[model samples]
Target chain A: MPETILQTRALSVERGRQSIGLPDLTLHAGGTLALCGPSGSGKTSLLLALAGLVRPRAGEVIIDGQPLWRLPEAGRARLRGRAIGFVFADYRLIDSLSVMDNLQIARASAHLARDLDRATNLLERLGVAPLASIRADRLSQGQMQRVALARALMNRPALLLADEPTAALDEAAGDRLIDLLLDLGRDEGIATVIATHERRLLPRLDDTLFLALPAEAVA
Target chain B: MIRLRFVLQGLLRRWGSTCLTIGVGALSIAGLCLIFWAQSAIPEAVKTRISETDMVVGPKSSGLDLALCCALQMTPAQGLLELERVQARLAMDDVRPFVRMQVPVAMGDSYRGHRIVWTTPDIAPFYGARLTDGRTWRQPLEIVAGSEAARSLKLKPGVRLTSSHGLAADGDAHDAAYTVTGILAPTGGVLDHLLLADLASIARVHDHGGEHDHTETAPHSRVNAVLVRFTSEIAQASLPVLISDSETLSAASPRLELAKLMALARPLIDGATIVSAIFGALAVMILGLSLMQGLNRRARDFMLLRFLGMSRRDLALLSIGESLLITHLALLGGCILAVAGQSVLAGMLASHGLTVSGAVPFREALTLYSAAVVLSVLSALGPTLRMSIARDDEELRA
Candidate 1:
């Protein structure tokens, strides 16, 4: 039992009056976990809670042994930047910047000394290095997805959280991306948690957690 | 470095919106520049003529109006001073009188319906005028034309022409033919538009011919206004009283009149500047709104940067940098446009017979630039504060 990099116990989230709860999820270092659920089943909510992007209505989220919410706002933000990488479902690339600049910003934001060579290498590894100088808006969805991945890995974060990372890719491209993500996680010795509705991706995960619909809904 | 990259990327991505903002800013800047340039140029132009004149004497009325007419060549009110009385004042020790008559001469006849001004050679020298063509009026019935008048009438020296009553071609005609003597050089003064001849020429045409009557019994000659110069030793204070108390004359000082005129015009100038400033403030407000909206969209991006390890202070700095860059570029653009516009306007006014001189005022330019920068920064305050204080948790979701 290696220590968990992120642990959320009985976490609950409320939007308006509706509430979503995820119970006792523990993610250890150097592993890949998949969060599977149907539409509106709160998979995204659970992911946000673990990433420290959302405040759980109940219970606590401990990242690398420190209660994330207990820290000062600035302290928590610094921890997130240093330890976490995110691949948003929308691939939120800064469209005004070139692909290379996007990665550069991510690296700098992480408080890491800018390493142009490392950024170039990551872009090359993700097969987006050639598009590095092009504006993000000019790139296609697959290219943008790759650039997003490169940005996430720029700081070699302790944990990587991805939401529907393969949604915009074709089957062949999706598999390739998943393979790259897994390989990158293994190489960096970082934990990765992906939330998605795509069941086809289930076989590729190291472990799977199904977020069941609430009991009242099942009835 | 990463923050810089991100901001740059953001600007590029929304280039259409960015360009629109820049254009709006540029236009306001340009407009401010033009207004300041014109306002400053007018006062300088007025001052040039005022500095040249020792004093202006005219009928009792709005001193400003008289100043505007006599010194600036604006149309004067219909009041005539007796020419002989003015001439007598000039005869006093150390008094040099430069008398001018407003020959309401434009209305009678036009050579081909173009307007002509009937005046004397003193009209040219009184305003320090030069000839662009042949010569100033050397003989009676010989005319020295203004550039516009010359261009409009298509007249050259050596040509002979007739006059119409008043300034219109349809006005009554005077049968006497006058020869074009010399065209006056452009002085950017009121003399540009007047038709210059000897006082005898005007008297001859108007049939007011009479020998010099030195007798105190004679009625004073009919003339418009007179410009007087003191010969170093004669006190100006005594002259006005002496002229006003005399049998039939009133005198107005050019310096005093212009001061009064400027005082009356002060409120109007202040109102215009205030309105301009209000519009500028509104523009800044609009810029602030746009920036605030953009901050909302970039909230998640800011969080992403935070999550990547950027400090809140760094993010705040990035916002300020972006604004400063835009403001600086806009200010530069505005200054260039204003200077160019001023030169163009000055040239046009000179061509139209009003001499405008001196560069645009540096203080005015500085005022506009400072106003723009301050307002722009103030407008940006809302977004900058919002971003700086934003919670990381709130930003992560979007």
Candidate 2:
């Protein structure tokens, strides 16, 4: 029933002398798309292209009715800062900074007013509020992933791109993380794209995109 | 949107490297300041001390020896010039026309490690010295101590001290004690370290029994040197020739001699300056390399900042700001250390009867300080520009 927030048409990304193309896809706000693939299938590449971090060799990535690739890198960066939040597979938080500082990085880059209280509330919602003052490197992997999710939500972006968010967590923690991501999308009216190899998380999303290892990847 | 605190945090995390780099920068700056002090302040001090005297006439010897003994109270002359000959020449119509004033000085004694100088009362006003305590020396066996000599020897009005035979404390002391009749105000020159007395006092101390003697062996009557100020510019051309050719004494231009001496020292000064500059550049290079290497290791951190939406220009500025902060700290430390070092050097040279001004000349200091900053920033340029132009995720992928 919600309005469409993300759509891609004939998107093809060049990867080392070969091309990986995505099928035309559209998703509404409050919807979740689970992207599953084998190794070397270009799942991270596709997520990166959708997040305006990488350019596509052909076709268009449309987010909120704006052509993401048509904008210059700076323009695309601004759009990414304003509308897209990403959680990398490695949870690339600055090790020298504390958990609160990691979240403040988002607000700083997007020129948003620093609201530590709001970041703390999001951390509390993500169940890692107790680790707020601890440096990021001192946190456990599961704790780091949760902080990454909290940081991703810091800007309150409309579209969240999570690449292997629960790859290092146990089954129960992974399920809890998936439930939290889906519930946040439904409650905040966000469009979420999660690229993961875990098949268990596929059925819980609103829709799924399956990718196979490319012929060149095998060669 | 790059907060400077992020750069600060990164530096603090690598505090060891940061402090070592800053220390190197500070040492280089301190060395440069010393060179600047030498190249500018010392010569200026010499000029300030000798600017008034036009010519120095002494026993025929090296011009340097004449200038040093006559003006700076440095080095002893070979023998005294005949006072009668100088007097007879001054009485001549030809020489009297060019000579505005002539103050003859006699030396050969010391009091508490300070040179005891003998000259007439006319020499006081010639050097712009005034009595800050008591009256000037008007009687034999009475002395006026300069401000520094009075303080260092702990002499005041009415205090008495025995004079040594030669210009050193190791010499045998004379039987008679010279009364400190006055104390001269600080002139910020070699005079501040001299004990001034009338020529009669030195005559009494050396003669032990003679009175008003103008004999050649009498140290007081035989002038060691004469400080002459010309009334007209023509005196410079006319007088030295008239004195050196007609008389058996040397008439050396004090200013010319000082300039020649400084010129002779130019190579040494320039060499030291070059070495200090090289150290400064090396320090800057090490600082730049350390910061750049640190940045390499923290490439992912910058990538994350870019991912969070900070622009590359802001990143570059942040890096530059960090370097500027270190350089500013080095500048401050260098200035303070330079002052301390200059004071110590001035103190050591005071014992040699040389004046070194405490203040570093502003122009040279500014040049060195500015160069330090420029070199530091230039060294950081390559790394900052590299960081700025790098594509997002390039560092992360590497």
Candidate 3:
């Protein structure tokens, strides 16, 4: 039996004045799920809430069979650092740091000791090993996204939550990101839930969840 | 490694402001340290100098002037005191028993801005000065240089220096040359800046150009002052009786005169302390404001850090760590500057006949160091709080 990496029941979140009620979901290890909705539909809110970055207004979010919000905020943060990885749309890299440095920061955030070999290995696998010494601020958007993915995978987390990870990239870069996510799922058994408006990505994912219709989306 | 790099780069990002803030902090701490040193050490140095002599008997003038001219050699003699007349008063039945030791000083001359204090060899031990090099003046016209005076004027044993007729360097130079016979070690008192010699040197210089007269018997030409030590407490009380009959002499209390002199200097000391305190307060405010604004400028980056699995507490610590780095650097600079400043101030004071050394007020330094660190932490508090409350779950839209 495949181990369920992510499970949610009756999950709801407040984004601005809109309260979003999400569908029940289950994602097994090495599975990929897509979250699609309109601009103000709280897809990003659900991603944050599921990643334990924000608290849900209702229901339980279970990651690896443990209730996420039942523990204290510190515990949730620790779990987020150790067991989960998040990729932001803008890459969220400290501009002054190099690509390898960004990966090392992830290790520190996870309360893990530095492993230069692990960082080097992750960057090499992402095909940005030559750019490891290059500063994040100088990288192209596609390169930054690759580096961000490498940083997210630095701790080898069980779950990866990405919010529009390919939104800023060109079509070819977007397609490449999709391939990376799928390969990571297939080979590394890293479960992924991506919030994106990309229509082509939906068919590639193992499952899809619609957070809100265009008319249902509210500020 | 990246966190450390960022902490350092954050400082470099605003290099101009960072340098300025560090300079201000250093100046403030150094200034406050100096104020503490000046407030306590100057008066202490002066009191230690004047505590040995009970009274200064000089030609009738203001008691303060007589004490200044005689005991401290800080002022010019108004008139000469007859040696015979000064001795006659000590031989009196009433004043005889009260007199313990008297070093009659024949002044009214100087060499290279240092006072030429001509008395017997006993003045060296009287002022707690020991010979660091060579022996005391045995024959007339031989002299000993105080430690600082030797350093400044470069006078050593066997070096002959010409004396001028007055207390300052601009006075008329005399033809008689006095040979430096010895150098006194530092006494941390008034003795470290004087040129001491026997009374016959002054007598020879004044008695019709006695240049070749190395004799100790050049006649009792003059006595400008007599530094008297009382035999007992009752002897100090008999100062009035000793000077009552004498029409040409006045007794000045060294302790009383020194207190008045320091009292006059109190205002300057207090003003310096206040100005330094104001600067210190201003520096703290600038540091606090700068740290807070720097954090705010990087608010998005901090939020990004939070999203990257860093806890809010960790984010706050990063901000505080930056402030602490700046403060610790400033503290090191301030200490170096303060010690250098103390040494310079001591040199300047020594030239004016008060001996101050480059000794740090340890208690004051420890207190100021603690206060500086505490103030830096307080300054960091604003940025810490701001970082702690910053929301990293920034995306509200889908």
Candidate 4:
């Protein structure tokens, strides 16, 4: 219904001798995709390649109508910094910094004018506004995850790539996190792909791409 | 460009290691400054004290001992130059032809632990001594106190003090009363610690006891040394040798003796410089290692920064900037400590018989601080290189 914001064509990312292949898929504005697989299923490798962090061995990933692999490393980096946001399993927040500073880090690095108003709005939406002055190290895991999600939106990125973002949370927190991500995606018209082993999150996302384990261990 | 607040927080996060690194660097810088201060201050004080006088002729003794006694007043003259010998040198065809003026100094007497230097009236103007309170001494048993002597002993122009037999505080007291006629301004010279009297007055003060046994005989009287000013440059090269060759007396060029003293002290100065350099190198190494360790410890954070679009080059610069912060702070702290310590040292040395004056050597200070900064930057190479090549994706997992 909306414009296609992300797509992949015969994309295969190599890890050691094995490769992870993604079905030719298209995600439009406000669409959500879940990448589900067991450990060592190359889910992270495919995610990295799509995010321009890993070079694809074959095929291509296209984001916002531009072929990602065709760009040079610095160009790809610039695109990722401006157009893509990453959320890691552990939140990966700088412990020494306050939540407010952590959220503005990427914006500052990209030379984008820091919009404290946007940061405050996102933190309040995430229900972590009161913790903005607290150090990241002092926040609970759920609070840190919320802060990390706020940081991912600091630059108002068009695409968010989350890797096992809910793996460390309890079920109730995990359910809230997934709902919040979907809600944010819909409200902001941002495309999102979540990579997770959590089977419970499967029904919530708009689409699912299951990465099968290599044949050697399927038995 | 790195964010100053972020960099500061990065360092503060590891404040224990950071403070240790800073402590080592600060002490090293302080050591370097002290060595530089000593290398410059000792010679400067000597040169300043002897700037006016051209030559010092004293009894036959080590040239250093004579220079110390006659020029610096740091040591007493071992033996005396007979008044006849002094007069003979003044009249000699070889020495007299070049001499413009000579002031004979008589010692071996003290007033309240201050050495009484009995010399001709010319000694006052030679040392640039100005009367701070009263007039110059004009007669026997009358004295002019140096500024330090006046202040420490609380003596005014009209205060009467008796001379002791020798320089020691416990030396036998002479019954003859010496009147304080004037107090000299602080000249920042050996003269600051001396009580001044005319040669005739010293003779009269010592004449009271059997000590008169010698001053009573004028031509046979002994003067410790002679302070000489030559009319021409030729006198400096010829007169000292001509007088030193005499069996009864020794002559020393104040400038030449000062040069020799510096030459003798060169090894100690060199040793201090070497020690300070080693300390500086050691500090750099220690600081560099700590920085490297910090980089390793913060690999995860650095990777996160990379993910945030911080380039490899920026990370490297961040590493260097952190080192610069630590180094400059340490250097500033060390320099402040050194100046404070030096001032305290100056006061302490005064009581122990050394006179150091003026400010710390600023040029040397600037040079040392610049070198330390350069060293700090250079020491960052290891950590920066590691940062430049680090794989954020790999390091974050580790």
**TM-score of every candidate's chain A:** 0.90, 0.92, 0.93, 0.93
lDDT of 3 by residue, B1-398 (tens): 66888788778887777887788888888888888887778768767777778888877788788777777766667667677788778777877787777778866678979988788888976776799999999987899999989999998899999998777789778777899999999876777888988887766676665454322222445677778887786665558445844677788777776677778988987888788778778778888888877776667667666656777778777877887888888888887898899989987876667776545578988888888878888888888876666455552221
Off by over 4 Å in 1: A1-85, A95-144, A154-176, A185-219, B1-35, B58-65, B76-82, B89-137, B141-195, B203-222, B231-242, B245-248, B308-310, B321-352, B357-360
TM-score each candidate.
0.65, 0.87, 0.88, 0.87
Q: What DockQ results do all the predictions give, each relative to the true complex?
A: 0.40, 0.46, 0.62, 0.46
> What lDDT score goes with residue B342 in model 3?
90
- Which candidate tops TM-score? 3
Question: What tens-digit string does per-residue lDDT give for candidate 1 at B1-398?
Answer: 55655666556656666555666666667667777666777766667655555555555555455566555554433466666665666666544443222222221224443334444455565567777788776667887787756876787999998776543446566668899978877666455555666555645666635533211111225455566555442444555655566455555566666666668877887776666556556556656766676677777776666656666676766666666656666666656765677788877775433566665478976777777777777777887788766655546554
Per lDDT, what order, best first?
4, 2, 3, 1
Per residue, candidate 2 scores C-alpha lDDT tens digits across B1-398 of 22666777788888888888888788778888887787777788787777768888878877778888778777765568778788777768988877788888888778768888788899888878899999998788899999988998898999989988677679777788899999999988667888988888765787666532333225566878888888887786668767777547887777788888988999998898788777787789878987797688778887777767666665676677778887888788887887888888887866677777756678877788788778777877877888867755346456
Listing every candidate in turn, what is its Cα RMSD in Å to the true structure after a full C-alpha superposition?
Answer: 8.2, 4.0, 4.0, 4.0
Q: Which pairs of residues collide in model 4?
A: none
Candidate 4 lDDT score at position A163: 90
Error of 1 at B259 (Å): 2.1
CAPRI quality of model 4: acceptable
Q: Determine which window of 10 residues in candidate 4 chain B has minimal summed lDDT.
A: B211-220
Model 3 scores what on Cα lDDT?
0.78
